[model samples]
Target: MFDFVRRHNRILQFILLLLIVPSFVVFGIQGYNKYSEGRNHVARVDGQDISQSDWDAAHRNQVERMRAQMPGVDVKMFDTPEIRQRVLEDLVRERVVFAAARDLHLSPTEERLDRLFKTDPQFAGLRNPDGSVRKELLAAQGMNSALFAQRLSQDLAMRQVLSAIGLSAFAPESVARAAVDAFYQRREIRVQRFDAREQLGRVQVGDADLQAYYDDPRNAARFQAPESVTMEYLVLDLPAVERGISVPEDDLRKYYGENASRYEQPQERRASHILVKAEAGGPADARARAKARAEALLAEVKKNPAGFADLARKNSDDPGSAAKGGDLDWFSRGAMVKSFEEAVFALKKGEISGVVESDFGYHVIQLTDVRGGERRGFESVRAEIEAEVRKSLAQKRFAETAEQFTNLVEQEDSLKPVAERLHLTLRRVEGFTRGFQPKEAKAEDAAVLASPKLAELVFQSETLAGKHNSQATEIGASQMVAVHVSAHQPARKQALADVREAVKAAVTQARAAQAARTEGEARLAQWKARAPDAASLPAAVTLSRARSQDLPKALVDAVLKAPAEKLPAWVGVDLGGDGYAVVMIEKVLPADVADTGPIDKVRQQYAAMWAGAESEAYLAALRKRYKVEITGKAKAAEEPAGAASK
Candidate 1:
C-alpha cells in the first residue's frame, strides 16, 4: 500500500489539490504562473522540481521518438487531448521512478557502468570510423559519461531490488504445475442458443397494439432521431488547378540535361585481394616471420596477377568478402574505404595494382571488369513527367476553386443561393441526433460531417429556428459543405406498450438473477456451517480440479482482486438476461512441493510485478527523504482523478 501510494504520489497530490482548492483559484494560479514562472510546474518528487522545462523536454523527446518510429506522423496528430495527457503521464512516471531510485540508495559500480557504456548497441553503433564513441549522439540523449554511469547504476539497482523480492516469493511446484496443466487443458462445449432473430417473426403485434407500443414512453425513444441538417455547397478541386498551369517541354529537357547523373547508374568494379596486416604485434623474431610471409604472398600475386582472386580466399583478413573467392562485389566510387576506392578506380581495365596500404593492412588488388554506365533517354520517362505535371496542375486548380467557394459563401451570406447558382446539388438529411449521422450522409461525405464549425452550427438553436444560412464546412481539400437545420425533434419518452416485451424480459432476468443469488448464498452458508461434512456438500456444486488461475477468467479476476486474507467472500454478478452467479471461495490450499523449475518460472513472472511495486515504494520513500512541494495552479493542471489511474 505504501509503495503504491509512493508510485502515485504526484497523482495523489494533484487529486488533493483539486479537491481542496476552488476552480477559479486554480485558474488564477495557472494564469499567474503562465507568465511569471514561465511554465506551470506540475509536481515535484523529492528535491527535484518537475518544471515545464522537464515536461516540454519529455514531451518533445516522446514525439520525436514516435516520429522516428512512424516516419509519417504529422504535427496535427500531437494536438489531441489524448496525446497531451499521455505525454504528461509519462513525464510524471519518469519523475516518480527517478525519485524512487534516489530513495533506494542503490548505485551501480564504475566497472558495471563502463561495461554498459561500451557494450550498449546504441552507443557502440555511433562510434567514429576509428572506433571511438560519438560525442554528439551521447549529448543528444542527455548523457555524459557520469550521467550515463548513473543511469546504468539506477537500472541495475532497480533490477536488483525487484529480483530480491519477486524471486524470493516463488510459487511451489504444485501451484505452478497445476496452473500450467489446467490452462493448457482444453474443454469443448456443445452450445445451443434461441436467438432473437428466430423469434422476431413469431412476435406479432396488431394495429392497436403497435400504436399503443409506439405511444409507450419507453418505446417511443427508439423513434427519436439524432439532429440532422440539409446542405447545399460548392467544391473546388485540385485537378482544375493542375490543368490551368503548364510547364514547357524546353524546361523539362533543360532539367533532365542539367541533372543527367541522376538518370545514370554509377560504374562499379569487382575485385579481391589478400590482406596482410603490419599491425599484428609479436616478439622480434615473430614480427620478422610475419613480414616475410607477407612478402612471399606479395611476390606470388605479382607473378600471376590473375591468381589474386584465388589467393584472397586462401589468405585475407577481410572476412566480409573472403568467401565467393574473396570477391568484393560491385561497388561504386566512395563505396569503399578512401585508400581502396582511390586504388581501385585508378587501375586500368584488367590491370593488377601493387600492394595498397589501408586500415585493414596491405591489400594486393585485381582489376576486374568495369561495366561502363549509361544515361537514360527522355522519351522513356516523358509519360511520368507528364503525369506529374498534370497532378500539380490539378492540385493548384483545386486550391483556387476552394478559395473562390469560401469567398462566395462569405459574400452571399447563404450556402443555398451560391450552390443553386453554381448548379450544385442540394442534399437533405434526417434521423440525426446530436452526434448521430445525417440521414443521407456517409462517412466519406466530408462536406456534411467533417467540419467542426458546421457541426456546431447545425446543432445551434438559432440555426434550428431557421434564422441563419446553412453552415459551410470543409471536409477535404476540394470538398465543402453547407448545412442548415431542416426539422428539430427533442428526445421523447417511450410508452410502456411499445417496450412491454423488453420490460417483461428485463424484469424476468432480474428475478432469475435474484433467485440464483439467493439459492447460491443459502447453499454456501449451509456448507460453511457444516464443517468437514463432505457428504453435505451441495450436489449442484460439481467437484472439479482448478488451479488458482484456472477458475473462470471473470471469477478468478473477482476473487483475486478482493482482500484474499479475508477470504470466503461471496460475489454475485449478472450473466446476461436473468442469469446470475454467486460464487463462494471454499478454501485456499496451502502451497507445497518446492522445485527449481516452478520456482524459476514463477520467479521470472513475479520479477516484473515486484519491480514495478518496489519502484513505486521507493518513490514514496524519496518524498519523505526530501521535502517536496507543488502549489497553486500547477497542482490543478493535473489530469482528472481516475484519468491516469490505468
Candidate 2:
C-alpha cells in the first residue's frame, strides 16, 4: 500500500491521483449520473444515486479482474451472493470516502490538477509521442479532463481526511515481533488415521431425520435457483454491416492523397547518459552532491570524448543501461523527461551535453544517432488507405441506417420487417443468465447474454407481463440490439421430491462426520491419560511452520498455535467436512527477530496497516452520519456503525 501510494510522488504530491491500493478491487465507474434522480440505482450514498449502469460497469470490471487472475476459474465461483455483496460494499466505501471529503470542505485547485496531468508518469500511456493529450484519447479512455479532475479532487480530499485521521496510529514493536515469529515458526506432528469413511456405519440417518432437516425454511435458499432471463434480441452485427459497405477505387485514392501525414514518420533521436541518482524529496545536500558528481563526470567525458562509453559503464547509476554503457537505444521526441528530451533533441548527431537535471537527478548525456522524418509513398500505403476508406464509408452508412432500423423496429409489430429491411438475422437465446460468462477471453457472445441492464428491458414489470419491443440498445459504436421477451422462467425453490436423494446424502455425511469427531475425542482422551505406548500414542514427527504439508492443514495450524507449557501439548480441532484431528504439539520453534533491519520494516508496515484501519473506522462513522439507502439485497456492511462493530 505504501509503495503504490508513494510510487509517483517525485515532484508530484497527489496520492489520490496515483490511486489508493485498497484491500479489495475498486473498478473504474463510467457514465456517472451526477443528477441521479429517480434512476434505477443499486445504492444511494449521501443522497447521490449510484446508477445501475455505473454499477454494471463496475461489476463487469470486477469479473474481468477475477478472470485475469484465475484463467481457469469456474463460472460458479462468481455465481454467489458473496461476490455481488462485495462489489456493492466497495462502491459504498468509495462513496463514503467522497462524502467525508465533501463534509470536511476539502477541494484542490484546478491549477494543481492540470499541473499533475502534464507531469505525472501514470498518464504517460494516455499521451501521444508529441507529449500532448488529445480529447479523443481522453474520451477513448473514458475520462474527460473535467470529469477526471472532479473525481480526482474528491479522491485527494479523501486522502487528506485519511491521513489526518491516521496521524496518531502506530503498531507496538512487541506485536510486530510476535506476528513475525508466528509466521516463520514451524512444528511437526505425525497423524493417527481416524477416517470418517471407517466411521460411516455408526451414523444411521433414517428418512425421518433427512425429511426434518430438508423441511426447514432456512435450507430453502440452498435449493433455490438464481433469477435469470431468457431474451430474444435482434442484433445489427457491426462486422456484417461493415462487410456490406462497398469502397470505390476513386475514394481510396482521394483518401490517401488527403491524409498523407498518417503515413509520415516523425524525426527520431537516440542518446545515452550516465546518471547521478537523487530523489527530488530527499535532502538538498544529497541532491547537491549528486549534481556535483554528474558535473565532474560531464567534464571527464568532454575532456576525453572517445572514452564516454567507458566512463558511463563505470560511473552510471542507472542499472538498466549501465551494463550496456548507458545505452538508452533509439527514442523519439517526448520519450524522455522534458529537460532531458529538449537537451538531447537540441544536440546534433555525436554532440554531448555538459549536464542535464531531471526528477531522477543529473545526467551527462551524449547524442548517439539521429533519423530525419520522411513520408511513405502512395504505392506503399495504398492497402492501408483502402482499409481506412472502407471503414469510414461503412461507419457513415451504419450511422444513417441505424436510425431507420430503430424506427422500423419500434413501428412494426414483429422483428420480421426490420430483419427483412436490413437483411439481418433475428436470433433467440434461451436461458440467458448474468452468470453465463464466456470460457474464451475474446468471445463476444457472453456480453450480449450477460448484460443485466439490457436483460432488464425484457424482464421488467411491463415487459414480462406483456409482449413488447425494447428500445434500440447500442451494443458497440457501430451496432445496436433491440430485445423482447418471448418466454419467462421465474426463480423458484427446488421441490422436496426432486431433492430427496440429495438431502439424504447430505444428512448421512454430516452425521458420519459428527460421529467420527465424537469417537476421536474419546479415544484421544484415553490415550492422554495413560503412559505413551506405540499401540495407543504414536511418536510425534518433527515438523516446522515452513513445511507442514504432509499433515492436514487444520491439524498443522492447531499444532503451531497450540500453547506449550511442557514438552507435549494436545488440542482437538474439528476440520469441517473432514472429521476431527487431535494435534500433539511436541516442539515450539520461534523466529529469531532483531531490533533493526527487517524488523524495522515490519514495524513500519504494521503502523501503516494500523493507520489504514483507523481511516476505515473514520469512514464508517461518516457512513452512519449520512443516509445511505441501498436498493438491492446486499447487507449494510459499509455503514459506519456496522463497519466499526465488524
Highest TM-score: which candidate?
A: 2
Candidate 2 residue-wise lDDT, 456-528, digit = tens: 4555555554366777777555668887666666667777788888887778778878888888798779757
TM-score of each prediction: 0.49, 0.51
Candidate 1: residue 88 lDDT (0-100): 59
Model 1's alpha-carbon lDDT is: 0.53
Residue 202 lDDT in model 1?
40
Q: Taking the tens digit of each residue's C-alpha lDDT, what string does model 1 give over 1-646?
A: 4554455444433322222111111112223224324445665544444566555555565565556446675654675556655665554444444444445666677776666656755444444565554555445444455543444455565455445554455545565556544333322111112223333334444556555545666755565433344533344345434545567898678767776787786788877666776563446575555556666787898888767777888887678776766678788888888998899999977777766766656677777778857777898776666667668666656656666666666666556776665555555555543444444555555444545545555555555555445445565556665555555555444455556666555444444554554555565465446533433332223112244323355444554443434444445443433233445544444333232245567546545555566656765564465555544132333332222211
User: Candidate 2: where is the Cα deviation over 4 Å?
Assistant: 1-186, 193-210, 246-390, 437-442, 475-477, 531-561, 592-597, 606-646
Judged by whole-model lDDT over C-alpha atoms, candidate 2 comes out at 0.70
Indicate the residue-level lDDT of 177 in model 2. Answer: 76
For model 1, give the 10-residue run with minimal summed lDDT.
20-29
